[model samples]
Target: MMKKPGSWRQIVWLLIFTLLWGTTPAVGGLFSSLSTEKERELGEEFFLELNNNYPICTDPFVSSYINRLGHKLEAQLPPHPFKYRFYVLDDPSMNAFAVPGGYVFMNSGFIRLMDKEGELAGVLAHEISHIYARHMARMLDESKPVSIATLVGSLAAVLLGGPAAAALLVGSQAAGQAAMLKYSRDHEQEADDLGFKWLQKAGYDPRDMILAFKKLNKQRWYAGGQPPIYLSTHPHTDTRLVELANRLNMHADVLPKDHDNQEFQYFALKVDSLSGSPYQLLRRMTQAAIHEPNNPAYLYGKALALAKMDHPDEAMGALEQGLKLDPGNYFIRREMAIQYFERNRYQQALSLFQRLAQTQPHDETVLYYLGRIYQEQRQFADALSAMERVQSLNPAFVEVYQNLGTLYGEEGQLGLAHYYLGLHSLTSRALPTALFHFRKALVNLPLNDPHYARVKDQIARLEKMKVKVN
Candidate 1:
């Protein structure tokens, strides 16, 4: 039997948050002694490790929307040294976390739970506050010296989750755990206070912060004693709720009542469609479409769920219906093109993708699909051009390097092929494999070849990285 969305989220949350509880002590002062530059360097290292281990949501629309929202909240803050980057992890847990420096992550399930844009903005603002106030560094400054091996082992256990987390906390002292819990609670309170202030400054109602907490609090009841990790780390107390209400009352005359935001609604639907069981999502979206017969968003969501369930014909029909309601909907068009591609309707897919490329020039997903279509049709040059654009727009897209390598290899450019394959391996964190490819590229290319120098430099960098890891 399929797990209900609520149950699924609870289980996933338990696994992910267990890491936070188990590893908090080790993380406390891990980066406190480092300079700002060193802190950022460590953050980059953490980000890379996560990308290698976890499934990060690379959907262009989802990532861009979340980043834009994060930056809007960030704009209301005073100048800070670190550059902020927002990411949506592919996990279905109801939690968000901020690491040292300015890296913030939100789970896909958590985004789906939000009803208003301000609720999400409030969450992001709270995370930003943790980074802005240097809470991690401060906490670490007061912590005792812990072995580096123990710290690494604890973090790995958390990331591994499930049975590993249980084993990690098997012998943890109760006093140490209690102290870490108190420390976490204190940080949560400070984040909430500062986040509320920033949310108001950014022209979002401060009450939305209260609403966000209320929603999480309600989830705690649904989960009984095993509440989601967000609640565990940031306990929702009566006093906290009362304080937030009082703060909002002070600005009641100036604050506007929360209303539905179309962007939030659309993105929430998208996240839900992407994360939930296909059959269940299709059932839910089907009912939603029937109730609001003219709503394109519902139809679009239904189309995606249908596609997920391997009902291509039904998915295409739904997209066509949605297009009739909103012909200019970029999302609907993109879905239609994807469906066409899946059905081997090459010309139809190519036509739609080309049109979309003209309108959404910087849309990485659009360009990526366009490249795929071109590749399938044996238009290697066009495919290479499209992929190059995608690479320039988002280097974090690991697939572009893979595709580029394949295309170059097909075109009899062995040196270039090896070089790109090396890059693909590097981005995927297969350092030794990447070094091998880089070496092969250098061996194949003539000494005077322009790329020979580049490949040599890459080889040197990878070797240094391997040394540092050792």
Candidate 2:
């Protein structure tokens, strides 16, 4: 009656969903069906899961900067009322994908190759173009049954190979889907044209777009022994490069003048600071940069590289030094906050988080962490308030509901407790979380515990259901 969880039908739908949501676009064309709300929601959930699980790379600065860049590009895109969000995955793969709805994933490897803001803007703009054109929806239309097929194949791949091996095959299968969705040669050309146009709109170098592609092409070839899966998803490197060149030739005189990105120096420095290497090695890199004091970017990079391998006390000192030189450096503050959070100094972390919240009041991440700190301190009221803000900002945050349910259960508010607990049950996979909160309620309530009896029964039933599913 419950569909027996992970039944053949569920497996079939999962595969269909994965394929429908997994592949990249063909030439840059738009489809009408993506305009629908249900498809958009499904696409959003799929992408959010993909990103949460298999991020692109590991540097915080790159992830944050790309998300900023994405928002800027999204603001400049053609108006169609739908939720659009951009994220940089913590991966080193040199590729980008636009999922159903407007979710975009850019890899860190893409960010590392970027020298100018325009190149980064170009990449984001191209992905945005796919969303505006509804290219993913069109691809889904053509590959309808492929979703079911790909999903089944993916499940088989997973069952046969385990999750890790399944990931490898999934990437390849996704590339195959991308090849099939290839926008018309013309759509591809238009995307290049429009993407560069937006890069100029965003006040970045148009040529960087061309250069980024060339660098990717070279990287592909240089990776002789290992063929990068990224190349598999991308259009022909030579073709893309030529198209960019031809566009630049046509608009050579009219193109915006090359712009210098002061932020790029900060971005690069922030990334280098987080790399894993010996302190001596980092000190040497910093020493070389210190010798060339005229180059502020190099100086910043050296400071970051040093801080990465230095002790926490030393790292804080180095961060302060860099901040002294560049007083308005937001990245330094963010990085410092990260260091504090990592070191388990929640009091200091709370202070930094509060500061960031003032600037980014609606940031779910800031609220989530702020709430976490309060929870750690046993300030349940404050924790609930903070988490409530996050839930309001992004209602899809299932964990926030779980946390709120837990807080309510602890406070003996059974009505509020069960409401949030039921909300958590609808969205979360961790049975223990719900079970723990419900059990807390059971213990605290009246000995008669009418609500306790109901919850106890529900918990038992759910546990039995889980056992069957397993």
TM-score of each: 0.77, 0.67
List model 1 lDDT by residue over 1-470, tens digit each.
11122233443343244344432111323333556764565456556555655667766556666877888888888888987888877666677777666888888777877888999998899989988887755654455544222333333334333333455445543223324422266677788788988888888988777787788777767777576666555664556888778877787888866654876877777677676777777788878877888889888888878887888898999889999999898888987987898799989998998899899888877888888888887888888888888777655455578899887887778888899998887766677777888888898888998989889877775665442322
- Judged by TM-score, which candidate is best? 1
Question: CA lDDT of 218 in candidate 1?
Answer: 78
lDDT of 1 at 19: 41
lDDT tens digits, residue span 1-470, model 2: 00012333443444445455542211122332343653465454454334333423324335445566777777776677566666554444566666656677665556667777777777778877776776655665665344332422332333222223334344445435434554555656666777777777777667887777777777766777443444554556678787788878887777777766878757644543443333544665567656765444554455455455556776676667767777766656666776687689988989998898898776666777778788889998888888778766554344566788777767667765765775465344344565565565566567675565766764674464442221
- Off by more than 4 A, model 2: 1-38, 48-53, 56-64, 144-184, 225-228, 249-254, 257-260, 268-288, 294-310, 346-372, 378-470
lDDT (CA) per prediction: 0.70, 0.59
